[model samples]
Target chain A: MNGTEARTIAAPDLLEMCAAHMRAGGRMQMAYVWFPQAGATPEIRYLASQGANQPFALWCCRPQPGEALPSLAKISPLLGWYEREITELGGVHFDGHPEPFPLVLHEGARSTLPPLDPRYPADQPVEFEAAPWRIPELGGKDVQLLPFGPVRADVLESAQFLFFYIGEGIIHYYPRLFFKHRGMERRFQGLCPKLGTVLAERVSGVGSVAHALAYCQALEAAASCQIPERARWLRVLLAELERLYNHLHYLGYLCHTTTLKVGEAEGRLLEERAKQLNAKLTGSRLLRGIIEPGGLRRDLDSAGLSDALEALRREFADYTARLERTDSHLDRLISTGVLTRKVAVDQGATGPIERASGLDRDLRRDHPYAAYAELPMTVALREAGDACARMQVRIAEIETSFALMQRVLLLLPAGPVRTDCHPIAASEGLGWSESPRGSLYYAVHLDQNGKLARVKIKSPSFSNWRAFPFTVHDSNMMDYAINEASFGLTTAGCDR
Target chain B: MPLWTFFGLTRGTATTAWPASGADNGQTGVLGMPRHYPDRCQDDCDACAAACLPGAIRVHTEASAGARLDVDYGRCVACQLCTEVCPAGAFAPSTDWAFGVRARTDLVWAAATQTAPARALSGMIRSTFGRSLHVRHVDSGSCNGCESELQALNNPFYNLHRLGIFFTPSPRFADLLLVTGPVTYAMRAALVETYQAMPEPRWVMASGTCAVSGGVAEGGYACAAGLEGILPVDVYLPGCPPNPAALIEALLLLLGRAPQRIEGGRLAD
Candidate 1:
């Protein structure tokens, strides 16, 4: 582990150690069961970090036969999703786990063995029968339930939402997402590191560069390959470019939710321009097929990037200023879908969602990936934790992203963009990047043949999705879409 | 004056005059699909096939044919790994982005003589719903790339609604069922239910490489090989995530409002 510390501890000591780590202000980033060889006991790994310039601390353990591991969900609520996934996919049991239910697999989906188990046949299909979502029973007068999606209104990702609302006000909200889970992590198994970047880029289309950067950096660490200076700076540029478009789209989509048609059109037009800039710089509108393990797949011409940045800076200023002064949009967002600071930290909120809740943690400044360590970066924060606060945080971040991109272009070094990278056998590494949404991590484990043994993705949306229902539980139905747009959560990221 | 109105006037019109001949579809100097040049392929070379993660390019060997490259553009995600790894320049980087076609057979390329591609939509479909097309998009399992582009279609730059194409929330009112992703097992039933709900004259368009032939996640544990074997796909537009312009072109081509630029897996002038 290049920038992390790994410890092998007894399975029983896991909970106590994790509690101590949390007390020391470290946040749990990822927890997954790693299956090495056939018939071998599954190894559970817990990764945590205190953010910014702190090395990741990973604790690994293997439970004894029939010994159920103590759940970490009590200490960190977000680990419930991880533990539920571990149970359904890895067949691991956690004692005293709250809300012990199938997280990834639907009710009627069947498999002879856990899909993550090495003994499970890859060719065998996991048979699925369309089963009704297990929405909880909440008894209250006038609290009628309305089940929306897997197929939702407008061009939204598939996820079912059970709204237990009293007329227009929501009493309880239960979301059943992951309808778009394409076995992304499992697809990485047996793939060469070169092709792994391709799959990673498609993990979340909008977060293509961030995902690719994280995946490539993981492999790069495994190979002990130092990417060229130009490539690192270029990575920063591309990442910021992605952030620019995503934030712009978020703003536009938020407007769509608020019924601000003119604002929506303007924001989308700017987003389209930003995408065109991406196309001009990297040949891919979504900025895919450009990044690889060692470095960039090809060199980018920065000649036009600066000119585009200048034009965008002027246009974005006008857009955001108008948005801030707009009373109707601000009024709708001000106190709508409020998530307090304590709940954000407890539910493991990352990215802008956590930032809006007044948690001043940013991986770019904290973990310092790519060229972020060298580049001057600022973290945007807001205390309100409402839709308006989330919008303001994104607005500030868009400004920061623009500044960062400009700086990268100014200081981009001249060198070969790529290096010869070959994965080392039986090597593994952890890589993280501050994606447009939040901290995205890729854990790569290579087999004996230098092929990917297993890859676990911790997408920011996965963390934020766990934190989303908190805001909707007592909110109104009218503000639900606005709240969601403000958070900018994607089901693909969560499902993957 | 209202701030929006003032800004709108200053920015002027951002819409592109595409689908009306010689307009920039906004995809300039962009790499589309990899153009397969079998003539330039070196003997005993399998670099392109090995590099292709989606198995879009395969080398089929037979006693009569010896060895030949079989390329299915439908399966290509346009990663361009083939173009990079091919030492012989067998696969060239191309900008021939407009690949929307009526028949699935039009997307598969072979070293042998190609079969004729399908004709335009029937007179009933053309005459009945040529001017207006209502689409119901289902994300069986996408990375949200297709959805991002789909949303962009409504942006001022593209404004697909100006061409009489609208995304309807209800499948019952839709004339076209646009499907994206690899048709993940979890989303299959929902996709089917949506198609079943569409009116009798409904058509299905497999939008994106994942929808066309599952792209990279094809045949994985969670998903099938896209909409091909699952549903009757009338229009197949393949891209990792097609740009907004490509989506508009595909929708128009489906309504028989535009010509099918790709035939037998080759882009025609």
Candidate 2:
């Protein structure tokens, strides 16, 4: 595949077009396909339906060879993965696809090809062969293969990374996940909207509010439900607080990883104080129960407002003082784990990772949702793109969030916390939010009965995971932990 | 000394001794819930039951009389949603935060019972000298919030280790297995395995709503019913995820120390 010519193929031109786009300096992002239900199709009928509210159309084609694959350029580069996914799951082959293999399921599983329809024999067990995965065996070279954990010494819910090292310097790192894959997505097949948000909340613990907000937004948009102004503002407040605490904790982790005691202590202090304030205001330390389907479950009173603001102001002041005294911590972070500005842009990194690389792209700023448009948001940027740069971006974000919280508190409108939300008769909508990890997008399709026909969540960790393989190249393996901590990628978000 | 140093010395002494005095006076810091109110109870409202995440609040409405709401202190996460959302302001958080008990039945508070007042001697003895506790955490497949807060205990504010409480890595060394999340099907085996590994003096503390009663994952094929189905949970900390202070109080209670309690509209002290 050359750069100049766009390759044309008879079988699924959409897949070929995606390959051509990637060959021509465009990166193949994400791709997945869904099938709509006509209520009669039986072969592949068990596949989930793309509800009415999703952004893209679910086009079904016969299992014949030679169809004009739609051009990939029409959709965002991130949609590339979706295309490959559709081919593998639906057996709709994309001719000239760079990597044509099964994605979600194991390889060589079933004998009879499942129809792309959603009404087929829903329980046919298919025999499939596992796909080949390369673990990069370093062998007898100076680079030793080290395996870390499917378990950690700490009580947190995550796996560890084994670092292959040469003396004090690390050569390679292997991250063992799947310790927390409880198959949440598989359970969403037949659930209604009211019950779906509960599942979304448990996807990742800390980002519960963000996930719930994104899921609700998708449902709301698909249903074309108008959220009250107060609900929107409260959502923004909760989201900013969520982002603030997460970023603060990330900074603390980064400092701790670098062995900077003072910085670690300060970071820990800020996090504790932030959580305390969050509980004082919203009642949940992690801000869980505050978010309900249509709007907030409860309202924040005047006393709550004053107490939260006062606590935030004091913490912010203390943070600034501590920052001045932690030069040694900053020294270790500045130039380590450098993901150059060019690489960050080409890879389409999002959130603080992109901001640190000097790419000034923020979902709040670019696609302003909720109260973010009302206030002036200072998107922090750093040219280094290293672990240190990432830390700086998080610190700046915390500062920015503190300012935003104050603004929201001052401008808070007097109104009811929620509006009466009714079941959607029939609708579909797209919902996206800038989670602490990055941009989180959800496409929701509602059945005629107002139940969730299908839901597709694109979490930031999916895209950021690509950057990890690239970031670790030619870098010492020991820095992998620091690099990963700086990124704060959630496996649950990605696996979902 | 510099001005900052002088201030630090003065402030450190003041702040360090505050927790000790506050604990003695039946105040559990800023995070602690206020004392519960009996007079303000309304016949119509069961606000605490509705707000409870773990369904720890049991409300019975009488046809001839007013409704009664019973809160199982063991099952309460101390999210304070019940206190905050209560319209009549009848519900108050117990300033006596420490309430770890030997039996799950003891944590259950009956709204109908106007029983003999809780023993005052327990609060006094517990406040004078803190107790030692050993915690073993089991992930029933959670989002890690409870674990994170538990980890934060090593920090300055909570300083759990200073109270003779240590978080052991292995179940063999554990006195209590602190479980979080609804026991998912995938984690059910692992939960049982961890429980079996623990020594005999072991107690299970179900931390989140998920752990106590399968939380949001309740009724799903992936989730087991709750911790009790596999192992008997002695204490229940009810929140989607409980606050760090609430957890500390629960731990203190387990070590034979009762947090300061109020009786008949008066502080226990």
Candidate 3:
């Protein structure tokens, strides 16, 4: 096969070949069980992308319905969560799943019937329920489990967490998630592609632009439509601004945990300023209503955000300097909630988390989506896997985003920002973008009528949260707030 | 460090001088709720109605006038798509973020419709808690759209504490309960329990379109169409998620500290 070819393999050969690919340093990027028709059987597809620059997509599909599906997660433990999601939504049992717990569905939750299942009855009530939080048997008898939040202290999104501790030092924790689920995937089942873009924006308010961009890219791919050159550059600009606002919030909150009130205020100030800039450019602060199928709903370059961006650059330089001068702030970060390189790679961690751990994985550079192909990308990397290293990576990325936004504004190719995109029919397209937190992958399947059949959104938080319990292995409970803040994981993104 | 102290002192008072000092309440640059004009609406026009994604706009045709548009501000996301597609100048664009009102009916904007008469509040309760307020914010099931704006209320820019409003973690100390999200079924019991925990005469402010009318996810499997059926809402502040200034305006209106500035989806004089 060529450098970028995807070869579909048989079910029996999936586990063996996938292991072979991983042995050659490959990663299972995204896995989803897609439904074809109302009465037709669903097929499990695994997107296997390996190699740094010389990359080729190897997508494996298990075609047979009645046969025992080979669980690739058995070989790679990181694939367990995705496999669990596939099993729950498809209502199919994997042969040898290790952690076969519920990932999305929970107790007292009643959602759509397994739309993929041939025997799925429209009237059948599939109760989405979960048993009591199973505290893993660990440490000693003195270790007590303390429950925290569906309604929390500061954050907006909702998710319950069970903390297991012997004394003050935290040991183990289980996140009882999915409280913010709007049944997003089930709702996108038959929406028109145009309306689907609107729904995709709400997946995570913080990552709205990236999600909508990803969804739109998938829509364009399904329709075999190419958006205008100017729209590509505009998408890049909006995505960079989105990253800026998100990183500003992430950095601000992390500093706030250290009782740095002034820094927190400054962070929020910068965030609001960025939102104002976004509103001026895209007509929405969160960068919504701009990203649509085929192109943006409006052209941002015409809005002339260049002068405003230049001002941001000057302000950010000073802001970063003032915050960096505080040695005590750095003291709280160094060696706090450290994630090892082995765990980050083996578990397929992404975004700043992976970059902080020196994994050198970024969808923007490796996958080259949108206008990224137009620019020379520098994927920031850090050797240290601690909180300080993570912050360093993020700050460095924020600086880079400032420069990137300027580049997008200056070098933007002149053309139409949109083109006519017709309804797609019976096609599947994969959309991946480097969101503020990390890589966002969306697998969109269109029905014969070109309506949205299914959309599986893969958030970077999903992968990063798996490493969270591991990051808190030896850190003090007090330092946990700062540690989690440094990671800056969004529960809304994860829940959706 | 002395430098840190210097920087802190140098950046004094970034707060907007609103209400007391006549600051621009963020009405510039951004577009807000759409204003509907019945007289100007063309006969048999459904362009804006069809363009509305969340079904915020509906057309009711009469024999005399032919077509009339009714906008449910509760369901309106303020994406301004209706303004973009309206053939006639009927659905005009507005930057009206100060859409906070005492009654839920104030959110709906039917062409040629007048503002609903304000309902009388219990005078004893209003007299009990006069001015300074303690707010208990519950993220019933928001995507964090409203929550983000709510957080901004504490920033140096908004500086909500100066206005006598603060967020209390415990429902016990709260005078007003601020609710976000479309009120998912899983969160309904918790919301009820929190509401119960609050002292008597506690007012609930539904802060986003989702909490007001479940914006896009309205009537989904997991949730109701916002806080309508769940609790008696004292104030309905509608937007996709109201901006920070709007939230403040809503809070002030709830406390009788500020007057309702929007009537029938238009800025009142």
Candidate 4:
């Protein structure tokens, strides 16, 4: 499969193509399918995985008029939502989706059609209907539903589940959300490419680098622009640093919640030290404004890079020593929220969560992007899928990320940070990167005026949310908080 | 009962006696009027006006003098961004944190003409100390920055409990309501309910620019009005998001320990 080789197939043959790709031992890296309302036709393009020996395979297929695209229920039930979302956004209708409703964009809400459609106007009043999922009521002699917050007493961006019990055990857990919905997706439309970076960074304040990098990759790909080698290396450094900090913060939160005082203290110290190092390197403790399209806004000096490396080494040793002595902390986390390997795969969980569940899948290694292709990465795995298993995976990944950062810094190439990128004409492209959470996918279509026509960002949170309910099935309700904390799911990332 | 108890009984008393002391309660002075320096002006800069989330700073430009900056301390939330971003270091926050006055007119002190007056509480030698305050916090739809720092008060560093400030879970038990965020439409009723539940002699302390004056979310449909529009706010601690130190000072001022002035820079112990 070559880049120039695009195979066009009828809509009825969409599922057959997917089945064929799977049989050929090809993995679906990303799939971007769109249909103009006027044309009422679907165009499917995907980068399928062949073996390591072959280049990335690209395939394009379209359904003929009055024909239906194949359903995903045959391949996997999880693909149902993905198919429905593509249908709702691009006006493509799937023949046999078990459930089909708008995923991110609200139903009936006014939105621009696919960029290829000339008949659809830009802005219109769109009304959105609420999703039709019955809120499960736990009915027992004493069981009741308790909604904690869309507005919480604490200053956190999430909802809580309280399972009212007589004394020690929980009866049911009710989940609530939509607290801080700033209408980010609606605002992303018609935004200039440069300003999109700011929007992406705010998607998840903690996962700022990941979101920005993914968005930049999409923009770069669409415009056929090349980022400098030095910038690519720096981008990887920032991404890995983000991953390290997020994992550290998650571990600290888990410790704090579980009443592991020493472990909590160590986690806090690691976070503070990491933040300070990040500040020294990027001026902002959160590493904002560091990543821009084409490359970075500023380059790291040798002295700054050296200081970061030194700080990393010092903190890593201290953290590792503290982790070793804390057996009690490990006891609380292990076997807590045990997601079985079968369940993890069925739910399509990714990142540390999937890897912890004995699934050795990592975008950095499986589908290499940016500097990851050249850098060595070891996929961390644990069979437990419990809270402790997740923590172990994160801990291992942090060490690996630190090593990768050190390697990148030692082999620092001399070049410019940014490349002069020209605006791209009307074209569509898919961008995928491994965010700290999981695989982040962005599908973008550029208009003739070089403005963003339509963008569908499938953040890792979207896919990972499905796995949460399954993990809490047999586990006690009290452990749910620890389970969620260990996952470090950002509501902002998911909501956006 | 142990051998160590018998040995420890031989130690002297930990109490200490000092010189004859007055009934001097450890209270800091009030904030003073803000001052401005002309030399620190930057070209085409009106940050004092822009950074004023309360819309307190008024910038006037004439043909000869270029730009003139004036701040209304009454409207100011004391966020200190003007001082923080002043390129010429012209805007100085006065150490005189206390500026308790009977009338609202006395609160508005111009920076250019006014001299730093004597501490406001120095003249009032009162025998009466205020009662301990019970503060109730309400989230009126803020960015959570204010609430984040506010939560830090419970931490070991800024132990708000030591300052006679207790956060009540219910507004009924609260003597003061610490409201953050601009009053969103959804939160307006809750705000009113919380304010109504508090007993008489009750005071409201708007803890951020959003609470005092709708900071960034001013004109949104979600926002109703600042805390003043719903309840009477006695003290205002301003910042895009106020630091923990500034928050501590504001709470202290409410308890008659610290003074309220438009001073900029670091808070002295």
Best by lDDT: 1
Ten contiguous residues minimizing lDDT sum, candidate 1 chain B: B111-120
lDDT of 3 by residue, A269-297 (tens): 88888888877766677888887888877
Best by DockQ: 1
Query: Sort by lDDT, best first: what order?
Result: 1, 3, 4, 2
Best by TM-score: 1
DockQ, each predicted model = 0.77, 0.19, 0.48, 0.08
Candidate 3: tens digits of C-alpha lDDT, residues B142-198: 777777788878877888999988888888998888998887666777788889999
Count of backbone clashes for each model? 1, 48, 3, 25
Error of 4 at A376 (Å): 2.0
What candidate 4 gets wrong by more than 4 Å, as runs, is A1-11, A14-75, A80-133, A160-174, A302-312, B1-269
Question: Model 1 misses residue A137 by how many Å?
Answer: 1.1
Off by over 4 Å in 2: A1-11, A17-136, A141-143, A186-192, A302-325, A341-348, B1-131, B170-174, B184-203, B218-221, B226-234, B259-269
Tens-digit lDDT track of model 1 for A429-492: 8888999899999999999999998999999999999999999998898989899899999999
Give the CA lDDT, 0 to 100, for residue A219 in model 1: 92
Candidate 4 lDDT over A233-344, as tens digits, reads 9888898888877788777778777876545545654664565466567644456666877888778764666666667667666665555556666676778878887767
* Residue A74 alpha-carbon offset, candidate 1, angstroms: 1.0
